[model samples]
Target: MSTFHLKIIAYDKIFYDDEAASVVLPAIDGEVQILTNHEECVVALKTGEVRIGTPKGEMIPAVCGSGFAEVTSDNQVEILVDTIERPEEIDIRRAKEAKERAEERLLQHKSRMEYYRNTTSLARAMARLKEANKYRH
Candidate 1:
């Protein structure tokens, strides 16, 4: 199977740097999949799940915060995001609290920017909780 260099860099650390067969992540329009030798372009990402298919046939799942991805001409994909966490790394209680806080913020009147921020926070928290639940044994 063909593979490409995939590097995922979160704000706190480098999450992944290795060869991958494919990657599916949340783009602004929706989910987008990238394979080896895909057309070079930069894509804006939203808060959602990211599934990486490795060369060894493992599907690695993660939740990611807002950011962008760059597909280079040399068969390399680089993702820079505000945050990324594997399902096992997620703190369910903390995510629930964040979701509640964001929901409370939504109920109050606020500036447009504040509203948007709260919504984004809500989305991120929801995504984290969903991913964590899906992987729970």
Candidate 2:
């Protein structure tokens, strides 16, 4: 099976670096799937889920904040994001608290900036919670 190197880096540290069979990224427009030898490209990523399929058939799921992705002709993919967290790394209690805070901010609805900020936070928290639940054993 063909595979390519995938490196995921967040603000604090490197999330992953390994060979993968396929990668599905959450782009601003939609989800984009990349395979080995995919054409070189750059894309802006949205805050959502990223699924990486390993050569051994393991699917690694992660929640990524808005960022960018670059694919090289040499079959190396680099993902740069503000934050990335695997399902197991997510703290459910923290996520719930964040969700509640965002909800409270939304209820206020004072300004557009505040509204969007809160909404984005809510979405991110929800995405993390969903991913964590999905992979929970």
Query: Which candidate leads the pack in TM-score?
Result: 1
The TM-scores of all predictions, comma-separated, are 0.98, 0.93
Across residues 1-137, which tens digit of lDDT does each residue of candidate 2 receive?
89999999999999999999998999989999999999999999988999999999999999999999999999999999999999999999999999999999899969999899899899899999999999998
| Highest lDDT model number | 1
lDDT of 1 at 10: 95
lDDT of candidate model 2 versus the reference: 0.94
Q: Show pairs that collide, candidate 2.
A: none
lDDT of 2 at 123: 87
Off by over 4 Å in 1: none
Q: Backbone clashes per model, in order?
A: 0, 0
Tell me the whole-model lDDT of each prediction, alpha carbons only.
0.98, 0.94
What are the RMSDs of all candidates, in order? Answer: 0.7, 1.2
Query: Which residue pairs clash within candidate 1?
Result: none
Instruction: Give the least accurate 10-residue stretch of model 1, judged by summed lDDT.
Output: 105-114
Q: Model 1 Cα displacement at 20 (Å)?
A: 0.5
Residue 28 lDDT (model 1): 99
Which whole-number lDDT from 0 to 100 does residue 37 have in model 2? Answer: 98
